[model samples]
Target: MNSSYEQELCNKKLETILVIDDSPTNLEILHDVLGSAGYEVLVEMDGASGIEQVEGNPPDLILLDVMMPKIDGFETCRRLQANPSTKHIPIIFITALTEAEEKVKGLALGAVDYITKPFEQEEVLARISLHLKLRKLNLELDKQKQELEIRVAERTSELSQTLNELKQTQLQLVQTEKISSLGQLVAGVAHEVNNPIGFISTNLHYANQYIEDLLILVRLFQKNCSNPGSEVEEQIEAMDLKHIDKDLPKLMSSMKLGTDTIKGIMQSLRNFSRSDGENKKLVDIHEGIEATLMILQHRLKAYPKRPAIQVVKDYSVLPKVQCYPGQLNQVFMNLLANAIDVLEESMIENQYLNRKESTFINPKIRIATTINKYQVIVKIADNGKGMSESVINEIFQPFFTTKPEGKGTGLGLSISYQIITENHGGNLQCISSPGEGTEFLIQIPF
Candidate 1:
């Protein structure tokens, strides 16, 4: 009994061969040979017990007798093969009825092979070993397939997470760029404001002293000699009274002009940087474009290439359009800045090729605004070397640029496109051909 229990436990890890035969001689002979060959063997005298044992604990191989009480080996094989759990276990039929049809019948009932009544111990072991090895290979393949599926799933999930992180990083980078640009704008505004303020401050100081001196002169005339002609007149001439009378109003007027310039700068800044506006408001698109132009004026001056880039504006009387003013300003900034960069690059290329403005074409950026009843169309055209179709097609895709690395972020056109189409429900289209220059048409509903 201890030996039997130990064998059963070993069979859990090793191959356990089940043999069913009604003949004691056949069963004993087969069990002894299989057990000697290092197989864990279980024997049943009848087919019924074999089926019962199969249901309880399936085996690696089944050896059966065709003749039996209650259930024959063929019937037993059929029953085992029909079961979902035991269907794959190899079944071998052993019988004394060696007629061709009887062997064929036994094999037909789901038997993998047939053993004659005087079966060789070697043949049975060889077949059982082959089938068991095949089963082992199949199980290993199943395990590997499952492992591969798990790996693919994990890899897919990781890629998805990585894509999300990259998108978030891109968004943060855009926000940082916007903040940096705004900081630069603020600095420029401060410098522009300080200029007029400085001159106005100095002029106002001199004007204050001049007015005080004039008041003293009036008091003297009232108190002492309101009609003392020659001496008072000589004193007034010595004070240069005629010059003060003429220049004092002019100085005050210049101070007022300085204040007016400061006021215009402030207004432009407010229009360009509508940071608090959330909902759409009626805004003059021309105002936004001009505000952006003022911000980028320093880049417009004459460079080494030729003269200053001439800005030709052909604006029609446009009614205010409802839109997000700040975002619209951003689009204008991007497009105008892009035009400037392209024109600069084209000029440099011409210089490299020893082609001057006389040989090539003069650089110009033309802005034309017109309006239909429902929409305002602003066309910004530049007379520089244009782009090929390939370049123009992908101009609005993020991270697409021909500019040298670090010189351009490549997000300008993409962001501008989004702001126009997605944010404002407007359209932005580009028209270009090689050597023919480029133009951007912007349309927004009024």
Candidate 2:
């Protein structure tokens, strides 16, 4: 009983083969042979019922008889081979026709091999076993191919992501070094100027007070000593005391104003050069922009060849933003300096070409700011020779520049883009066309 149960379990694990033949004798012979070889077997008569059975339950191999009542084995094979679903099933023709033409025809219709009628049982079992083994090997190869393709796709994606991350890291390091060096230099200059300006401002205040007290004493002397000697009157006339009193106050006030302007400029330089490290601070956005503009004041002034580039500021009331003030200032510096550069280039080009009919006659930069529900938007626009579409597309990429050699490092805009987008969680976009001017919009969330 145990032996019989083991045999049954082994038979259940074997491959299934379907036999289609009109003759009961051939069907019985194939069924017994394949069954004895430990292969599960199913029998059907005629080609139509065989196709129906194959569709319902596909077998690993098919044994088809050539001569049948309705459709012949050739037609059945053709139909099976045409279907993608059951096309892979190996079909072997069982026919008595010995004509070489007939055999070739069967093979052409997608038959793998043929068995002559009254065939040896051993030959039938051998062919079925061989085809079943080939089918199993083919299925495994297909599965392995699919698995390999999936792994290759995953690895390629991982490499692409890693490359992008490496580029971002490199960009951050370069920008940090550039900003640090520039900040140190500017901060040093501001520090050196601070003491002298402060001293002058303090002395100006006291000088103004002393001049007022002396003027009052002179007025009292003039009122009380009505009969003064001629010598005193002559000395006052020669010295021009009245003129001194009138002009001295004005001169002192002008000197005080000049010192105050210097102090304000120094303070702006210091603010622009500040480094915020890695922390965010609540700061006035406008103040940072003002500081950047002050630093670039020399570039904005009129030169021998070009007129002063007009900067129109249309500012809106903005709430203090929590941000890296120094980094944000850097972005402003790059954008404003770029605007100035483009305007100067346009002016120089026009002057060189002697083109009085140029559209950029008066180079101007307009800076506007606004706030929305989710973010702050700052727009800087310039009426210079605008960039072409192709140039605009590649402008944000590292080391892309339109300036001549030795004029630009080609990293200003690229670093600014990273600082705004990656560091601040913001966006920087450029809009421009030929002869129209360029505008860059910077948006940062509150």
Best by the lDDT measure: 2
Structural similarity to truth (TM-score) of each candidate: 0.53, 0.69
Give candidate 2's whole-model lDDT. Answer: 0.89
Poorest 10 consecutive residues by lDDT, candidate 2: 352-361
C-alpha lDDT of all candidate models, in order: 0.83, 0.89
Model 1 TM-score is 0.53
Q: Compute the lDDT of residue 421 as modeled in candidate 2.
A: 93
Q: List the residue pairs that clash in candidate 2.
A: none
Q: Give the top-scoring candidate (TM-score).
A: 2
Q: State the lDDT of candidate 2 residue by residue for 173-224, as single tens digits.
A: 8877877987898777877887888888898899899989999999999999
Instruction: Quantify how close model 1 is to the true structure by its C-alpha RMSD in Å.
Output: 13.4
